[model samples]
Structure formats: structure tokens, C-alpha cells
Target: EVTVKGRFLNQRVAPCQLEVRGAAAVWGDDGRLTQWLSTQHAQGTVAPIAAANGVAETQVHILTPDVGGGFGAKIGAYPEELLLGVIAKKVGRAVKWRETRSESMVALGHGRAQLQYITLGGTKAGKVTHYQLWAIQDSGGFADMGTILAPFMTRPMSSGVYAIPNIECRTTSVVTNTTPVVAYRGAGRPEATAAIERAMDLFAFEIGMDPAEVRRINLIPKFLEPHTTVVGQTYDVGDYETALDKALQVAGYTELRAEQAKRRARGDAKQLGIGVSVYVEITGGVGNGESAKVEVLDDGRAVVYTGTSPHGQGHDTAWSMLVQEQTGIPMDKIELVWGDTDLVPIGTGTMGSRSLQQGGNAVFAVAGELVNKAKSVAARILEVSEADVVLDKDRGAFHVVGTPAVTKTWADLAIAEKSTGGLNHNDVINVSGATFPFGAHVAVVEVDTETGKVRHIAHTACDDAGKVLNPLLLEGQIHGGVAQGAAQALLEEVMYDADANPITSNLADYGFISAAELPSVTVVHMETPTPVNLLGAKGIGESGTIGSTPALQSAVVDAVSHLGVRNIEMPCTAERVWQAIQAAR
Candidate 1:
């Protein structure tokens, strides 16, 4: 039946599959334990490992050094991490676990294994009125935090970017004879966006309407402040339509339609298809706060300590920039310290895209406090009242108001302060709520009708994750996330046989996409600025993965829709596409 209602991981992230990092643990003789780990969360890892090993919390010292490609998999203590501590205790020696690239395929956690059932009701004019989603999440042999949290997270995102008047969602986390599923890229949010977005496309197809038009008709109107969806997530400021408009403009959607028309008119062997997706995802969703400490050194340089951990998010460089912006310190002269429990005992660690908005904001806040503290010192040194002291930020010095030439440099104050208790400030930034970073994506793909092979052609995205702190880091996050999303849509999947034997458990056997497979993504930036925090920032960590999957998958199916094909399962491989085409015929 038809209706007129409508509607879509890696470091360096190169084409080749990269190796997962290793972990080593050592229990010392002083009843004090030390661990050398490569992880996204040092404090996040220590507590669990300590509990599992029957050690006191104070006895554990966790150190993280130069981790690579954590994404979401390295946030917590895995079974392998516990194994090291156990072995080290019995053998009286340090134990380490280095997973080979092939071993990681089976030993490491897998993500996004869900059986979803979605139904949507909408008007012929493209206004979505009601929606429903149900899913069976495969928790695999061991149920971890990711499995426990997936269903809860999925419910709040049921409404996605639309203002559907009525909505219902349900999910069951079940144990299966497969590798345990954990957070990867967008985690449960991606699954939510995927289902709703797919439902919208299906509704559009049934109603014979444009997918983009259907989305626009149902989008939640622009909001300058907090707007709560029916599903219970309160989004910060956003203009979803503007993001969509920008993506359409950059993608040249009208021209793409003309090309598709010609291809269909001629019944060409290769066909053009375009897919559109508009999305909103929650970031800093779990722990909405992070801690920071800033100290002004005698040399006029700054040292920053942060609770949030980083694998590839570049907290060092990003936090330095935050300090530089707030204080007169040069970005190069600022030093960042993180992920070591011995040095930083209290931390929330990194997960759920909470780092920059929480951790980075703390850096900015503490630096500003340090500047205020320095003002009194400047007044004393310059033989003036506190009211007379003013910062000359351009010259990185403090002087009396309207007296730029009579200035005392930060180095001078820092040196003087060394004898009078060096200036230091610490703070924790707590946002009122989790921010909803929204955006739109357009994917264009070419299909070879004769072979059912899909070729990625052009892609454009408008990601609005409130106030980008570092444009380069933001782009890198998007680029990396897009690659992982495209992989799941077009190729990668963890498989198991009837006997619970792992299949496609190695990079060679599993289909991982490469640079040769992906097109250069054209991204447009939109900054709506969240009011929840000082930086006016939200999380960009998972936006690309949340938006790219459906866009690419929908494009593949649209390419062959003229031939009666309506849907194709994910990992839309040549075999699956061929089978769908044959059955449709």
C-alpha cells in the first residue's frame, strides 16, 4: 500500500584496516599497583580493573600513553584488561596483552547489531503524524555497559529531527552467541536515526513524493533556545532547514535529479541516485561535566590538567587553544596533561562525546579565573590600586589603564608570584543539559545495473555542532566518522555461524572500505551555538556517523528503484543488491 507522506572509526582513517592498541598492567610490591594502558579513559579503566582484581581504589595507578583509534571501544575496562591484572598477581610479574589485527576482529567488541521493526504514519502532504520503532539489540555473549545503555539511549531519539505528534519506541537487549556488542562511533543514537530515517524514506517512496520535501514538511521548526522533542531530548538552538538548504545547495540536488532523469530515460547500465538525511544527536549525553586545572608557571607559560581522556580527539592541542583564547598565553607555550591517574587522580574520562564542551570549557573557565587572580598582583607590582590594573592582551602584559608603556609582563608577575604562592586555579564545568547537534547530509551513488555494484560518487554534509572550537579537529572527526558509517552501510559486518563460530573475523575476510572506495566529502559548517555552556559548543564527535549511514544506503537503493526495487539490507553488497533486484523483477 502507498501514501503521500515522507522523508537517511579510525585514526588517520586511511583505506587499510588499522591495528587496535595494547594494554599492560603491573601490581607493585608496596601494595601500590600501576598500570600502563592505551585507552580513552584512564580513570574509567582503573576502577573496574581494581574491583575485578580485589585491590583498593587508592592502590591503583593507571597511566595512558599515546593511544590510537579508540573511537568508543576503548572507554572502559575490557575482559582482556582484567586478565592482565589477574595474571600479574599470580605470576608476580607485569602482564601485557597485545591483540593482533586479526585477533581483534573476534576478541574486540562489535557494534550495531539490531533487528529493527519500524512503522510510520503521515499525511499525503508529507506531514508525519505518528511513528513507532521496536528493536532487538544483540548483546552477544557478554553484556557490557554499551549493551545495557543502548536501549535507553535509543528511546529518546525516536522522534529524530521531526515533530511527530505521536510516537512509541521499544527495545530488547538480548544475549546471543556472538561477540559482545559495544559502543562504536555514534553508539545507540546511530541505530535510532537509522531506523527513523529509513522509515521516512519508505513513507516517501510509498507516497510518490520527494524525500527532501517530505523531511522539510515534518522538520521541527527553527528554535533559538531549548526545544524539547516529544521523545524527551531537549535540543539547544538549531535551524535544521538551513542546514538542509545548505547541503542541497552544495550538492547541486536539482542538477543531480536532471542527470537521474536522463539515465532513467535511456535505461543506462549505470544509474544515478541521490539520498538525503537530516539528523539531531545527543552529545555529552551521559556525563555532562568535566574538570580542569590551570597554573601560571614562573616562565610565563601555562600547564593544564584535564579529566577527559583522548585517543584521537586531540585534547592537547584543542585545550591549549582554549587557554590561549582566554588568557594572553601563546598556544605554543601552553602544556596539556591528561589520562594519568597518578598525576590526575579525579576524572570522568572520555566517552559519549563529552570532552570538548565540558573539558575544553573548564580549561577556558579556569584560565579566565587565573587572569583575574593575576590582576591584583599586577596592581601591587605596578604601585597602583586594584581598580587601576588592566590587561593588555595584545602585548601579553598588565598595565595601568591608559598607560600601555608602563607595563609588567606575565613573566614578571609569574616570577614574583612564585615567592608569594604561585597562581593556580581549578574548575569543573557542568552544562545544564546534553546538547543536540543537528545537521543534514546528501549522498550520491552510481550503481552498475549489470553487476549490482555500488560506486560512491559525491557527498555533501552540513554539520552544525554548536561553535566549532578547532575547525581542523572538527573536520577530522567528521571525516573519520563518515568512513566508519559508510563501511557499515556498504561493507563491514561481524558474522557468526550456526555453531557460534566466528566468520569474517579478520580484516581480510571482513569487507573494510578503503580510500579507493570513498569520495572526497564536501562539508559545510553551521554554528548555531549552544547556550548550555560558555564556549557555546556541542559535540561534533558522532555527527558524521549518525548522518552518513542512511544517506549512503538510501542512495544505493534509490539507484535501482526504477526497476521495482524498494529496499536493500545494510552492507548493501553486490550480492544483496543483486538478490533484491532479482526478487523485485
Candidate 2:
């Protein structure tokens, strides 16, 4: 039996630096208030702004322009944003507010300031059967979204990819004088992964077993149907072991371990360490559903309106592709509209990795519905039954089953329906349930024992986000996710003085990860379509961040584990590693 315990410090960091908080509000000639802000959820902004200003939801209109990045920081409406309209009405003119870099650090909600205690018990042969985790969350000055993440996000995914029989998790939130915490990239999911992964590594160390082998033994068997964990969180579908095998193959796990053995035998100053992690996360699990509308214009072009706002995720390209695939319209001719309340009207915004699975699924469903509506128009013009007319899809036109030469194009259908509402379909699409996107990661690092400096030399990530829509877009999400996860593991921390004042408020003092510090990532693709959504796609947005964090952390710790160093807090800087080594000696 083996049990290990430590605090996984999820240091705070600014959500996004490129785009700070800014808002413009105007009290129009009418009683309604028109406000424009950088936010993830436009519909979400309506209720709060309406309540604060003592107006109806219809009276408040929110328009979201191009947002640089949200990372959950911009999801909630801030006091500054809420006051913009009130201030504008009082001043009798349009009001605009932009936060300075220094102001944004304090004003923006922080993320991932949690302390975790984890314990694992099993046989000496590496069959993990029991697990327990206790998370003490820092809610900061307010009981915001951060307050509930521990129980909601962390506790639900406590079992991860392991088939541990008995598991227990406890969460407690405390109000601190520091900045209020909100959701970050991975939010509470990363904290959960970090805790269990670190425990697994310690368990491996005690039994003198390979960490990878230990994980392989404990991973849940492949499942195509729904499977519920001991914590009562049921996953839609997962094939965790295949993902692990693929990641190991791509990363050359055996070769890396061989090199580490050689370095250990020679007592080299620079030691090689290989870390592996298999992760499963819940996505498309938040909110009621998403809204989507597809309309064919008089000029034959198509327009897609989505409830999922795009800050940086390529919703335009991806959504357009879904429309084009259904309507046979060229992608260049397809346009996407979002973020404007006057336009979208209803939205859950883009967070929790719900955009593609929920929002994109909406687009795909509505586009298909539009095609069906168009077929009736084609049948009316052709003087035939609706069943007799079929869409060619190649030409974006409808034709008789046996007569391809004669076709009625989308423009023709739009012109015929001009007397009515034209060729369009709009609705809110709901999924059967949340999907589980699972994956594995391999992180290889070189640690210099003398200086206690570590270099992340290689990383291979295999993420199964269900059926992929766009390979390029999927890769972009995974790459960005890996970078962010790697940043939290190696560098980036929000520091505070004794008086609860932030000292690392600016970029100069903060340890933000740069492209120079990251190695070119190797991404492996895996697909296990979920039955919950029409598009069969889960979420790739947070998978890399979730899987890579623990792998990188484990790699850093494994590098010095032979030196009697069991654990080190995150942002494993040279100083921290050096201190850990000295303490071990």
C-alpha cells in the first residue's frame, strides 16, 4: 500500500493580455440602452445589465465586436461593464471605457488559485483501486464562478481515465483578499488532473514501477456506450487506452525511457525524464443549448448566424464549412454573423469548450433543415411531389430524381419564396447530453541537475475530440491548449505581497510563456464520435490543456525523483527546482 500527499498550487494568471477590458455604451433617444463590449456571452450580458439598470431585457442590447481572447475572464459581466450604460445615461452621451494593462490585472477575474490534497492506495503491483481528493478553492473577494468550479468541474472528473473502484472527493471554498477567481483555459478540470496525476506518479515511485505502466494498468477499458464513474458523472463515450497507445507510439515512449536509463547509469549532470498522462474531460456540458440560423440570400450566397461568439476560435471558417457542405455554396460566399444581440438575440456564448459541439451542431442541423425547406419550394415550382425532388448538393440545387439536367438552384428557391420569409431556417438545437473528450499526452524534458534548470524538448499529444470538422482548426486548438498547459506547468504565476497586493501585475514581472520557450508540438489525431450531438464532434478546446499539464508536471518531478525529490509546486522555476533538490539532499 502507498499513499502520497502534497498541495498542487494552481497559481493565478491574467486570463488574456492582448485584449483588455473595454466597453462602449449609449442611451439612445428611446428608453433602450445600446451597449457594446468585449464579452463571450451577449445574451448573458442582457439580463444582468437590464437588472442593474432597472430595464427590461429587450431594452438592453449588447453588441460584441472582435474579442482578442476570453479564456473565461470575459464571460462574466464586470462592474465596469455594468456601469457603462448607467454612466452614459447620466452624462447624456455615449460613454466609452477601456482598462489599462495595470487596471486589467486587478479588474479582470483571475483563475486556478486552488490547493489540492490527493491520496491513492493500491497493491504493490500497480493496480490502483482507491482514490481520494480534497480541494480548497480560493474564491477571492467574491463568490463568483470560481466558487462552484471545485464541486462542478473538479469533482465530476475525479476518476479521470482510471478505473479506480472507490473514490471520494471533497471541496471547500474560502474568501480571500486576493483577486476574485474565475474560469481559465482548463478551469477546475486541470486542477483535478494535476492532483490525481501527481498522486499516480508518487504511487509509481513507491512501488518501483514505471509510471506509464501503472497508468496503463489502471485505465478504464474501452467503452462505446455511456459509462458512469464512481463519482456519478456519466461519460457519453471514451476509448482512453487507444489514445494512450497512440500518444506513446508517436512520442517513442520506449526510446525515451531507454535514454533516461542511460543518463541515470552514467550519473549525467543533465537527466532525461519522460512523463505521460491520459485524461478525460467533460465538454458541451454547460447551458441549455445553442442557437443557429441558415439563410440563402437572393444572390445565392448563404449566411450562418450562431449563438457561439468567436473571440479567437475560428467559428467563421468552421461554421461556414458546415453550411457550405449542406448547401453546396462556396465557402467564400458563406458569411457568419455573431456577437450582436440585435442579430443573434439568444446565445450561451463560447466557453466550456461548447462552441463546436453545441454551436456548430446547431449550424449543421439548421442548414439541413433549410435544405428540406428549399426542397418543398423546388417541388412546388416543378409541379411535383416533395418526395420526387432531391438536392444535388454538388450544385446547391434541387432536381428530379432521374433528371439531373433540369435543376432549381438555391437562388431560384429564394426568388420563388420572396413573397414569404424567403429560404431560411432557425432554431435552438439541443444535444442528448454532454460529451466526454478524452486523450493522452507524452512530455519529454531535460533537467540539468547542477542548475536545476529544465528544458521541455519534446511533446506529443493525442486528443480524441470525436469526429473532426476541420483538421487545421482542430490542430490550432490543440496547439494553443498545449502551450497554455505547458505554461502553467513550467512558468507563469500571479505573485502577491503580504498585504494582498499583486506584485507580478505586469508582463515584465509575470512569467508568461513565449513561443521561444515552447518546442514544436507533435499532435496525433483520434476520433470516437459521440452520439450526443448531430455533428458527432466533442470539444478540442480544453483537451490539450487538460492532458498536457499533468504530463509536463510529472515529467519535471520525475526528472529529480531519483534525487529523493517527491514533489514541487507548479511554475517549477529554476529557483524552486534548486530549492527542492537542496532540501532532498
Candidate 3:
């Protein structure tokens, strides 16, 4: 068994710790290295194997059998793994190379290297007057993917869910000797949310206004139609204020604040800080559609081939739900297959949360077509008019009106049609369109004035990614997003020395937040169904990241507003918070 594990350190800088302790043997067949890999892009890994073996790219076929999890870190092929194939070929023996967790941290790519200078100008009455964010991103050595990741994440959602018309955001990526930055959970959007949310709290403190009240005044009011931002993308639909109010109500913001005041009066060690952030994230932003092929077999079983790849996003469950809803196919009878390039050659893969909106929609459309085709075949078989026949979904078969006894099961219909032609239709059906998902978040945090230690106390989020297909899967997505966002706010940071040497090189050194550090995230589900897609679903994968980061940061600063503190940089670590408090004092 080849066990490969590596921790990606802050993007490009990966000091790997690998151990190959098994006997190296050779199959002695075709002299090809056949090893299982968990990679996002398979073709990208084949090149090094071919080059190292002194053979053509065709000689090396990198097959991704099963991937545990890859938050854009598994996109490209690594050099060390490629060397295994070469070593196997040179020695005419089988060699195994597996990475350790320590090695994975330094080797895997990190995300969000944005240094932001935010200046918020609002009124004493809690009206947002002006907002400006100037960011300098550390691209981390080679400008891998972070170059584009930073700007797309920082500039697009600069204004967030607010109606701050005088918003100005300028960002530039600077190369540092560290890990090559790539897309993490929320990628660059989380960085933007973090900066602006923290800035909102600073403005609220400067004006001596409640953080919630300040957000209410500035939030973009509920809009029936799409609204364009200063950054140029148009939001399909959102009730920003309603989301905020719902989240606040669910979280008991007023009570939390009352408790915070009590803790401060008694000089309690465990202080309470309430944070609120309003965010609008762009999901399915790539504008590319997903491909799905739904086929009904002779045995009444249905097979669904989807272009949207899923690691643990429950694509099997969610896509099967879509198929069952559209066609009368039962969940058990349907099998969902994906992630194989040969099977799904033409695919955009899964990134930027495009799976459900684009891919799921495709599945729905295909299932509809399959139902129509089945109905036509049933119409021919029963010698009844096509319009007169209707599908009895409860029975999973087509029945004639006023003649329920004369019904044909999908399996019988498929078998009856085999003598005439095939089960599938001749024409190819495809749906090409993209949808947008948006939401708001409220985060509560406590800050120690002396130590500057920021602790997350409570978090509430209201995200509207249109109609939810499955609430269970949706909640999981939100939970994962909240964890990543909270990590960005209170604990996680990819730091480097002055000469570009990475300081946080491993998971032990890097502050990856855990359940012990985070609060029980409160999710207030809101639906502002968009007309853009048939399923009325938008991407919910990144909403938590976009909304939670800002809220948490805002809360941290809001907790210490009475001390005359204006700003605190991301991670809001003990030292940074302490220094900010000292400077204010």
C-alpha cells in the first residue's frame, strides 16, 4: 500500500518528509509505472513521468483512482511523485513513494497573501460615507495561480453586500520566496471579505455605533432584480438586509452584546465580542456549463455521467436527488459516475463551486429529456396519443389515462424497444448557462485587551444560494466554509521571513483552526431563488467563506472599540492585537 501525504506550506515552499519503507519490486511486464494517484488534473502529472522515463507522454497514463480531498491543491502534478515512475523504469523495478503529513504541509500550496490598508469613512449617524481598500499581496515566489487568485478575490467583491458608492480598491501582487499560492477553500474572496469586514468594524468603532446597526444602515437594501457592483459583476437577487436581520435574530445579537457588557464590567477573563459581516460571493462565476448524460438501461436502472467532479461534496447523493426529481427514477436505481477523463472528456471539472448550479442543472435537464424520450416510446408501444400518456411517478411507470391497469414499466419499455432501435435518443442535448449565489454572515468574537488574543465566541450566517436541493449537503458546505473563514480571521496565517523564507512551514507551525477554537456556527437559511437556472439553485460552497471572514474580523475589532483601537490585521493574533491595543493606549 502506497501512502502519500504532504502538507503544503504557504503556496510554493514545500520541504517534504517522505518515507518509502516497503520492498521495491518490478512487475516486469510492459515496463510501465502503474501507481494510483489522487490528483485534480491527471494530464498535468503525465509529463514528468514521460520525461523521466525517456518515453512519450502516451507511455505514462496517470489515473486518479480516488481522491480524499483537494481544495485546489491537487490541481497540478508534483515532481517527487513523477520521479517514482522514472525510478521504476530505470531500475526495471516497482518503487513506491508516499509523503508524510509534515512533507505535505510544506509541499501543498497555500492561499490568501493580501496585505490590506483599509480606510472607512462613515457618518456619526452610522451611514457609510466612504470605503477604500489598498492591498499588497505576497504572491509567494513563482506567480503560480495566486497572481490571478489575489486580484479576482480582492477586487470583485470589494464592496461586499454594502451600498458604499465611494468604494475604491487597488491590489498588487508581490513575489516572495515561499509556497506557490493556489486556491484554498474560499481562495482570494475570503481575503477581500476579511479586509472589508474588519474595516467596517473600525468605522463603526470610530463613529461609536453598534456593529449591527452600522451594517443595517450600509447594507444594500433588498432588490427584486439584479444589481451591479463597482467591480462590474451583477448580482442576480439578494435580500441583504433580511439575511442580516435573520442571522442577528437567530444569534441573539442583542443578548450577546448585553452579556459582553456584563463581562467587561466584571473584568472577566473570558470576554464576549460580537462580530457582524455582510458578504456577497461569486460562485459558478466561470460562466461555463457542466455536462451530464442520463441513460436508462434495460434493467430499469439509470446511469448518470456528470462532468462536475466531486470529492466529498456528496455529488452522488445530490445529483441522484436531481435525477429522481426530474425523471421518475428512484435514487437506488440511479448510479452517478464522474472524475474519469475518458468518461467525462469534455468537462470544466469542479472549482469555484460550479458543481450544483451548472452540473446539477445539466443532470436535471438530461433526465427530463430521457423522460420525454421514454414517454414517446411508451406512446408508440401502447398505440396511444403522446399527449394522453402520463408517467405515474409513484409506480415508476407510464400509464394511460382512465386505464391504470394498462401501464408499462421503464424496464419493459426498454426491452420492447430493443428490436426497433436503441434506448437513448439520437440527438445530443446540452444546457449552457451559469448562475450566481450570494449571502450575509454575522460573527461574534472576544478580544483580550492586554494580550490581544481574539477568540471566536459565536457566528451566524444567512446565505441565499437560491433553492437548496438538499439541506443536509448544503449545511455541510456552509459548515466547512465557516471553519475556513474563521481560520482566516483568528488563527490561520501563512507567514514568511524578510528574505522570503517561509516561517510557517508545516501544519504544526501553521495555525490551522480546529473545533476547539470555533463556536457552534448558526446558519439561518434564506432563499432568493434566481430565474437564471431551472433548479433555482446557486453555489453555496463559498458563501460561508465570503461572509464569515469579514464578520469574524469585524467582531474582533468591535470588542476592543472602547479602548480606542481602530484596526487589527488578519489573523488578529495575540501579538498583533496586543500591539494594536498598546498603540491605541
- Rank the models by lDDT, top first: 2, 1, 3
User: Model 3 TM-score?
Assistant: 0.87
Worst 10-residue lDDT window, candidate 3: 1-10
Candidate maximizing lDDT: 2
Residue 369, model 3: lDDT of 82
Clashes of each: 3, 0, 24
Off by over 4 Å in 3: 1-36, 41-62, 80-96, 417-422, 425-434, 447-454, 498-501
RMSD of each: 2.9, 1.1, 6.8
Expressed as tens digits, the lDDT of each residue in 116-138 for candidate 2 is 88878999989998898999999
Provide the lowest-lDDT 10-residue window in model 2: 1-10
Candidate 3 accuracy as lDDT:
0.71
Candidate 3 C-alpha lDDT tens digits along 25-136: 2333664555446665444455665676677655554455546676666666566766666576667666766666755666677666666777777667877767777777
- For model 2, name the residue pairs that clash: none
Global lDDT of each candidate: 0.82, 0.89, 0.71
Give the TM-score of each candidate. 0.95, 0.98, 0.87
Stretches of candidate 2 exceeding 4 Å from the true structure: none
Error of 1 at 72 (Å): 1.0
Better of 1 and 3 by TM-score: 1
Runs in model 1 with CA error above 4 Å? 1-17
Candidate no. 2 TM-score: 0.98
